[model samples]
Target: MTLTALRRDAPSGKADWLVIFLHGYGSNGADLMTFADYWQGSMPNVAFVAPDGLHEAKDGGFRWIGKRPAGDPKLYDDAVEAAPDLHAFIDGELSRVGLDASRLALVGFSQGTVMALHLGLRREVAPAALLGYSGGLVGADRLSAEVTSKPPVMLVHGEQDQLAPLYGMMMSVKAMSEAGIVCQGVPLAGLGHAVNAEALIYGARFLLSAFAFREKHGV
Candidate 1:
């Protein structure tokens, strides 16, 4: 299935890096595409794409898979079942742009975060980085066996998040770290299950560092 996306080309009219935004469940691509506008000033060489989820949520927007609550044991199975389609989408986009994994970064929010961590970790070639907000990892028990890459990761969660609490993020980070993944976790005090200005700043910085442009003549 072809996933429709909103794209923003590099400000310089040429591109070197790609940042794919995956919105939370019940949210659409248009919702997160706004970040492109906010970030283009700092990442003029990076292209941004935000795609609608693979399936429509029963209540409203979209989903990467069947709708399920956070921390559900079945989420691992669901993510596994749903991964191929997302993988295809990412791979297809990368191939279309003539870019390789080194130039790619996946930024995910909520359920999108699950997809980013899962697929990013298993890529045959590691993405430049993975950034997740308000989301936790799934399939932790199987990560050791399934993981193929150890790309650096930055995860931010609201300390007071009720839906997917800070504990979940901590656990996820712990597991990834145990597996030798370089991971950073930011727990925003009193923040909820939503992104805040601070998180956005951190995310932007993470992307900049992850996708920094290195001129051929200089270090």
Candidate 2:
């Protein structure tokens, strides 16, 4: 299925880099476009895109997995099921933007974070960075065997997030390290299941640093 998206061209009229925002469960691409609005000034040459998930959520909006929550035990299976459609979307979007996977940063929120972690490492060419918010890695158990590339990752999570807490983020950090992926975990104090302005700043810096590193190394 072809995923629909909201896009923003670089202010400088040069798409030197790409930033794709993957919104949370029950959220649409338009919701995450705010990031583009806030980031456009600082990243004048970076184009942005936010894609809607293929599956529609029951309450409203869209989701990467099935409409309902499928507990932790099957979370991996759920992500696996959602993979191909998202992969196709990412691949198609990159091609359309005249960029490769390495020139992109996958910025995910909640369930979108799960997709970023799952697909970033598995892609044929690694993304410049994976910046995830309020969502930890899914399919962690299968990562060691399935991981194909190592990319820098920044996981921003609420310290008190009941849905996907800081502990889960720590676990994800461990999983990334075990798979040879470089991951940085940022735990926001007193926040819960959401992204705030500070977290957005960190995400922006992470993307800038990751892309700079990739270019410095000539990757």
Please report the candidate that would top TM-score against the real structure: 2
TM-score of each: 0.94, 0.95
Tens digits of lDDT, candidate 2, 17-104 = 8888888889999988998877888888899999888789888999887533423757778888888888888888778879877898
Screening candidate 2 with a backbone cut-off below 3 angstroms (N, C-alpha, C), the clashing residue pairs are: none
lDDT of 1 by residue, 88-202 (tens): 9988888877787677899999999999999899988888889999997998988888899888899999998988888989999999999999899999998999988889999
- Estimate candidate 1's alpha-carbon lDDT, on a 0 to 1 scale: 0.87
Q: After superposing candidate 2, which stretches have Cα over 4 Å from the reference?
A: 67-71
Model 1, poorest ten-residue lDDT window? 210-219
List the global CA lDDT of all models. Answer: 0.87, 0.85
Cand. 2 TM to true fold: 0.95
Instruction: For residue 173, give model 2's deviation from the true position in Å.
Output: 0.2
